[model samples]
Structures are given as C-alpha cells and as structure tokens.
Target: MHQPNKIAFFLFFILLIPFGVQAQGHEVDSLKNELKGHSTMDTIRAGLLIELANKLTYSDPNEAIPLMEEAISISKKTDWTLGEALSHRQMGNLHYVLGDNIKALDEYQKALALSHKITDRQLQSSLLSNIGNIHADLKEYDLALENYHSYLTTSQEMGNRADEIKALSNIAIIYNDTERFEKGVSYLEKALSLSKIEENDLFIAAITNNLALAYKKLDENEKALSLYLEAAELAEQMNNKYIEASALNSIGKIYLLFNDYDLAETNANKALALSKEIDAVEWQSDSWEVLSEVYEHNRKLPEALDAFKKHVQLRDSVVNEEKKSELTRKEMQFKMERQQAVAQEEIKRQQLVKNGYLIGAILLLIFSIMGYLLYKRRRDALEKRKLAEFNAKVAETELKALRSQMNPHFIFNSLNSISDFISKNDIEQADDYLVKFSKLTRSILENSEKKWITLEEDIELMKLYMQIEGLRFDNKLKYHVSMDNSLEPDNVLVPPLILQPFIENSIWHGIAPKKGGGNIDIRIAKDGTMLKYIVEDDGVGRSVQNREEKKTKDSYGIKITSSRIDIINHLKNTKGSIELMDKAEGFRVEIKLPLELQF
Candidate 1:
C-alpha cells in the first residue's frame, strides 16, 4: 500500500517541471499550423518546432522526437544556444515520460552543458532538478540529494519562490523515501510555509499531503489524520482530484489503524471514486488496501477477499510498469556501451599513428641533448674554478681591511687606559697595566694574520685583557667564563677578537661606575648549527652610565668589532650577530656565530 502511494507521489511531479514548452493553453493542431507558417531556417522556426513537439510529448511522444531533432538543427543553424538547450531538455522529458531514464539523463546532461555555456541560471536550475529526478528514480539517493541541493541553492539565489518550493519538496520526497522521516518533515515544513506565502493552492495541497505522509511514517497518526484532512479539503477547493484522492486514501489508512471500520470504509470508498475519476491506478490500489483490512476486521470474508483481489491486481500493474522501466534502462545502457566501444577503437588507431612520429622525434632529441650536455659540462667546470679562485682572493683582502681597522681601534683604547693610570699618579699600577697590555697586544697581532682562531685561544686572550682592566680598577672587577660540556673549545673556531669589544664595554661602562664594583660572566654553548656566547655584567646598569658619561671608550671599540663581525659573516656566508640588552642591575650582550669545526 505504501509502495503504491510513493509511486503515485512521483507521478505528480512530472507536471511541475517546465521543459520543452508552455503549450497547454494552445491546441496541437494550432501549434502545428503556426510552425508550418514559418518554414525559414531561423530561431523563430526552432521555437515553434519545440512548442509543437512539447504539445505532442505526452500524446504522441514518438512523433515528437523528429520535431525536437529538427528544432535542435534549426537552433544550431541560427546560432541560438538557448533554443538548442531547451530542445535537448524537452527531448529528455519525452524520454523520461517513455521510461528510458538513461537516455533522459544523457539529454539532460547535454542541455546542462549548453546552459552553462550560455550562463542561463533558470535553465541550469531546471536541468539540475531533472537530473536529480532521474537519480531519485534509479534509487541513487546520495547523488539525488547532491543535485537537488544545487537546484535549491540556484533557485534561492534567483529568488524564484515557485522553483524554491519545488526544490524543497523534491528534496523532502527523497528523504522520506530513504526513511529519514525527521529530516523529511523539516524540509516539507519549510516548503509548506513557502507555498502558503506564494498562495499557490496546488503547491499547498501537494506539500500538505506529503507532510502528512511523513507524520504517518513517524507514528504520529493523530497529527497525520488532521493534516491529511486539511490537504483533502485544500485539494478539493482547488479541484485537484489526484491530490484529493491521495489525501483521502491516507486518511482512510489512519482510520483503519484506529479500527474505525465504518469511517475507514467510507473514506476509502470516497478515495476510490476520486482516483477512478482521475485514472490514478496507484491511489485506487492504496484505497482498496485500506478497504480490504477494514472488511476483514468486520468479519465480512467475501467482501474482504474481493477487496484483497482488487488491491493485488492494481499493485501488480504498478509493479509491471516498474519492470518495463527497468528493462528499457538496461537496453539503453547496452546500446551506449556498444557505441563507446566503437569510438574507443577509432581513438586507439589514431593514437598509434601519432606514436610512430613521436618516437622518431624523441630519439633525435635525445641524441642532440647528449651532445649539448657534454660540451656544457666542460665549459661549466672551467668557469667554476676561476670563480672560486677570485672569490677567495676577495675574501682575504676584505678580512685584512677589517683587521687593520680593529688593530688601530684596540691600540687607541689601550693607550687611553695607560694615560688614565699615569694621570692618577699610580706609578706601580701604570707599569703593571703597560706590561699586561703589551702582552695582550702581542697575542692579538699574532692571531690577526689568521682569519679564525680556536675558541680556547680566543678565551685566553680575553682573560689577559680583562686582567689588564682589573689593574686599572685596583682588582675591583670579578669575572668567570663557562663552556658547555658538549663543546670542545679547541675544536671550534671563531673570528679573532670577536668578543673583546663587548667585554671591554661591560667592564668600563657597566662595572666601573658602580659603588662596590661588579662581576662579569661569559658563557659559551652549542646552539644547533651555531655557537652561542653570552656576556653579562652586574653593575650600575646602562641607565646610570648614560647619566654619568656621554662618550665612552667601549663605544668606539664596539663599532670596530661590529664591522669586523660583518666582514666575517660575508666571507663565511653565515649569520653572525651581536645583540645587547639592559638588565635591571647591569648590561648584557649575546653573540652568535657559525659553528665551524676544525677537525
């Protein structure tokens, strides 16, 4: 009984799709005469052909085929894409009504491609809906939902209330067919609201009836009965006998469920009369099903058997139509596969001819490439050797220029310290500072010729320089140097005197201005591919130093050191940097350089 109801429901949707033509108000003979009056190969003739064909699509679909084909031909001749697309879509509708879904889908697809080319949103939406209908009929629910959603979105964008209601209702039917009653109810409710807003009596009656069916499936029989009654009343007011019969049959089913035999019999008989008037076999079958159950409940065995027989007969007719549709689908599929096989053979033959020429060209190209690569290899090697030699010489010259600037800057700062000690009348301290400075100067000069020195060697040179500064402060400075256990200072190389300037700044500026003096800490650690160095001093921080002294010896030393580090970075192609930050009580400096290993 429910199967017939579903079949009857889909049969009604055919009238909703506006395919080939809006020819219902005109007669077939009149359209044929109008088409005959225009015999020229133009869009007017094409349109007339489509209209006449659509007029006969239901009555004589076989005869309408040639008319649609001629319309398509004329549309092509006139370069009218819209006409061609509509004709193809109408052809699809004819095939669909004849139960050949495969051919119908093919025609719809063709029209869809043409519609997209012409940017026709209305035609595109209709084609999507048609494609979805075919997928729904074939029980491809996922594909059906996908296409239906696209149609709904397009309709919403266009603000077409009628199409929007149609999309919503179509989607609801799929959900209901798939047994997702809750989702079906949601879509149908939205569609019902839209239909009422549009004041379309037919749509309202159809949507109300579907909504009731969803309620019945959910076991809400009382609500279903009320809605079914409302749908029947709406359909009757609109003079829509098919929807009226559907709603009445559903009402009868509900009454039978309640065991109200008299009312069930009355509603079922009324539904049967309406279905017969409309020639709706499925609805008649549903009515008979309800009556058969009602008769059996009343213990009327003869009447029950007769009603059961009628129900089975009508059900078989519906089933036989479904079988015919399936057979037609299979026949069309076989024909399509056979045509594709022939096309594939032609493509393969063409490919073989193209491959023969391609092979000869590839062989010749390979030989030419081999000769070019051999010559290019020799020329590239020669250029690479010359370029390397020139770059090495340039790096050496730049390194010496940077070193020359640093030596003079360092000597100037050292001489200033010596002058300071002597001015204070501290003879022994001055002499001691001069001796230590001389030794530090000797070490720097020795390492200056080399581009890089071991970390251990550089740290030793720093210790001597700091000791010299300690004498100037009368042993006021305290310092400590630490190295990570994972690093071997002797194996790592850094530029000479890279850390001296920052250390000198920490002592004179960061530590000397403080009341009790301060301590300087130097730390070296392995940081991935780079060597990390941190130099921090605990003293009267930079803020205090800025107030006391405007110009400091360390500033000049730091400028020279930064320039030297930049040169080292350019030569080595590494990112070496100097960063200085102020601590609450002092100043801190961090330096990173490429971690080059000697061994």
Candidate 2:
C-alpha cells in the first residue's frame, strides 16, 4: 500500500512557483464566490481561479479543469503572462494527479516555455522537477533524470536548502522504484540531514517519511517504524494532514507486520478519516489496504473483503489503462530493438565462423600441396598444419560463444540503475556501482576475445558478476566465492568467461524467483588432475523449476557452454564434464575441467 506525494517540487519563498497557490483556511465555495466577484481585476480573478484549481486538484479534478482553462484565457487577454504561465503549470499538476501523463507533459512543456518570460529561477527550477516527474511516470528515465539533475543543480546554485532537500527526496523516489534501495536510503539520509538543519517541520516530515519507506524496502522495519513515528509527530505539529495520514498508514502496515491488530486497526482508521478529510484518493486507497490487512489477519473476513473492494475500486478508478498500455508498448518496442541488435551481432559472429572455416581449409590445402611437392622433407609439416587448422576453428567458435555470454539486457539495466544513484546525489554509491560495472564490462570485453585467461582473472570476473547481480536483487540474493588453498589461481589457466553462465543460471533461475530471495555458493576445489567448480543455490529445486518452465524455451547458454567444454577436452587431452543435480531444496551444478597451468 502506497500513499501518494505531489509530483510538484516544493516552492521557494522568493520566487513562488508560478503554479503554486497555497489557499489555506479557505473553503472552495468561498473561493468560487471570490472568483465570481473579481471579474474586472483579471489578476485577482486568475489568482482565485488557480487557488480553486489547486484545491480541487486532489479531490475533484473534473471541476478544476475548466476553472484553470478560463483562468489562462482571461489572463492572456489581460496581458498577465505570469498568470497564464501559472495556469498552465497548475494544469500540468492536475493532469499528473489524474494520471493523464500525455497531457501532463504537454502542459509542463508549455509552462517551461512560458517560464523563459519570467526571471523567477525558483519557479523555473520547480518546473524542471515537474517535467522530470512526468517523464519518470512514463518510464522515460533518461529524460526524467536530466530534468531532476537540473532541478538539483538549479537549487544548489541558488543555495535553497528546502528546494535541495526536495530534489534529493524526489530523486530517491526514482531509486526506490528501481529497487536500488541501498542507494535510495543513502540519498534519503542526506536529504533528512539537510532538512534537520532547516528545522522546518513539514520538510522534515516529508524527508523522514521517505527515509522510512526506503528502510522498509530494505526490510529494516524497526528503523522504518522509528522514522515513521518521528515523521508523524512532526507532521502533526505542523498540522499537515498529508504527511500525517501517510505516516499513520505506513505505521498501520508496520503494526500489521507485528500482528498488533488493535493498534493497526486504530491507526488505519485514523489515517482513512484524515485522507477522506483532505480528499486524498490515493491515501484513502492505501488506508483501505492497510485496514484490509488488519481485518484479514484478525479473522474478520467480511470486513477484510469490503475494505479490499474499496481499495481496488479507488485504485482502478485512478489508474488510466490507456496510459499503461502505451507505456507497455514503448517498453516492448525498446526490448525488441535490443534483442534485434543482439541477434544481428550473432549473425556477424556466425559469418566470421564461416570465414574462419573457409580460410582454414584454404590454408590447409596450400600447405598439403607444398608438403606433397617436398614429400621427403616436409612430412612432419603436414601433421602440424592439420593440427593448427583444427585449433584455429575451435578457438574461433569458442570466441563467439564466449562473447555471447554477456547479455545486453543485463548491461543496459545495470547501467540504467546506476543513473538513479546519480540523480539522488548518492555520488559515493554511484561511484561504487560504476566500479563494479567497469570491472564487469572490461572483463567481458577483454576475456571474450581471448582463448584463455588466468584462473585468478576468471574468479575475479565471476565475483564481480555476482556482486552486480546481488546489487540488482537488493542484496537479498547472497553469494559466496571460495577456492581451495592449494590451487594457485594465477598459475591455473581456464577458458575465458567460462564460469559466468553457470553462476548466472543460479542467480536468475535459482535464486531470483524465490519468495524472500536466496543465496548462491560458488566454490572451486582440487580433484585429482581436474578442478571442480560447484555452483549451488537455496531456491526451488531444478525439478520444480523445470516443471514451472514447461512453456518456456530452454537456455542456449548451456548448449554453448557444453560445446565449448567438449572442444577444450579434445584439444587439451583432458576430461571435462558438467553435471546438474536437483537437490532437495534447491539446485546444484558442477563443472569439472582438467587443470592446465601457465609456466
């Protein structure tokens, strides 16, 4: 259950957001009467119109729409540029709240274009965040990030602590959504620290609330609850219903977690009343969900069902299915393009293999003809030539297979995740991600093009791969890398990018689908003249996983790895084999390869 936050950035004092109208302690009907009476003063009328629009934005957006349109037209006719801009900006926020992302973007752009007419850097900065938020909602992350950075940088230049914290908090939201909770927590901590300096109750409540949510995602419920309590108290002191309601709803969930039925029910109902008081549809939905959970666990089946139905009704009414479909189509198209690029790369590799075979045959034929002409002296040359041709073909095919081991989707998603850290101002975390990303990419590029790499390099590359995957899974997927003490990894030689596929299989197939996440163990030990590499996971057994995979196609990586192993066995005069076992609780894979050493 998630309570909603306004997508608009907090307005700075000196330069009020063109769209901002803090109409507090005033009734909507009174504002309408004021709008009706101030016709001659276009500025006053426009202001009243915007105030009504802002108030209705969260409650009854349908009525707010025509009011904002009338305000903009009247303001333009009266040559009130700022009023017109404010109308457009507020209109954008209204659309965002209603889930009309396309119209939201258009209105935000119009606001931004008009922002150039005014010298209010603060309003302009807020517009950047509004633009970024809409882009993020549409899953256009790159554009969203660009605007968020602009928001942060603008506030930093202006030295507004409030705006800076707002930017940080919002950027952390993007991180939380992307499952980069560790980095998200870092960002939230920074924002919370800065906000504490300001001693602004409303700002403090907002940041701590976000921090609580980030901690909750990391499964640190105690920390989450503590922060939520602090946020609730701060929000109450400021008489802010939005923050107070959000905190109460979150607290109710925590209570549910601890099975405190009475406390959960009490807090959820309080939050529900507050949400309804403010006409916060999203928070009202969240309240219903928490209440449903409390009822369900308390064995009040009828109440639970009723609460659930209300929650779904609100959620379904707010979410626009057409926008969801459009976003899905865009995502699908992007994936298809990426897959096509990978396929085209494979085609090139296949053509290279064909060329290698043709070239090898031609070379062998030329050598054989020469050997026949000088049969007495070159008898040994023919045998050497034949072996060279075979080795070359094997190496070429192995190279192609090695190159295929790095999935483009994995690389793109990893890189995309890193950008979230940057936006949140968690530069340290961003740097750490970049380091791991650099190691992974460099290893793939360098080793895939090589015939063999030191076992030490191979193990290091595998560790980096697992570390990156561990981050993707929010560290819920634990992994271990260990080797026998006697095995000198630097002296031992192995096929390049060899262990990655098996480890990847354990991660994606074995650990990832587990409910609470699982662990992977990669260990290497000496077994006679061969090195045994074991990959194991505490997840669904292979038998169960296979059963679940009935409609899914088999992985081609395994086939490629098997073929590469066969080639290595024949060329190196060693036995190599891979075995997959379905363990009682999970899956285990072992790869046995003859130990080859470099002098």
Predicted model with the maximum lDDT: 1
TM-score of every model? 0.56, 0.44
Output candidate 1 Cα RMSD.
34.6
In terms of TM-score, how similar is model 1 to the real structure?
0.56
TM-score of 2: 0.44
- Model 2, span 256-332: residue lDDT tens: 89988799889889999999998988789889988877876775655655686587567645543433454443444
Question: Tens digits of per-residue lDDT for model 1 on 1-599?
Answer: 00011232633444643343545535777887887787788988888888777776667889999999999998888889999999999999888777677788899999999999999999999889888888777677898889989999999999998888878988888899999999999999999899889888888888888899999999999999999999999888977787888888989889878978899899899999998997999889999989988976785644655686577568757855664555444445445555565576567556655665677768667556545654665575456555554454444443443344335545556566666665676656655775687577667656745778899998898899889778768789999999999999899998787787677778767788888888999999989988999999997776754744624645565666666666667767988888878788888889888899999
Superposition error at 205 for model 1 (Å): 1.0
Q: Residue 391 in candidate 1 has what lDDT?
A: 51
Candidate 2 worst ten-residue window by lDDT? 8-17
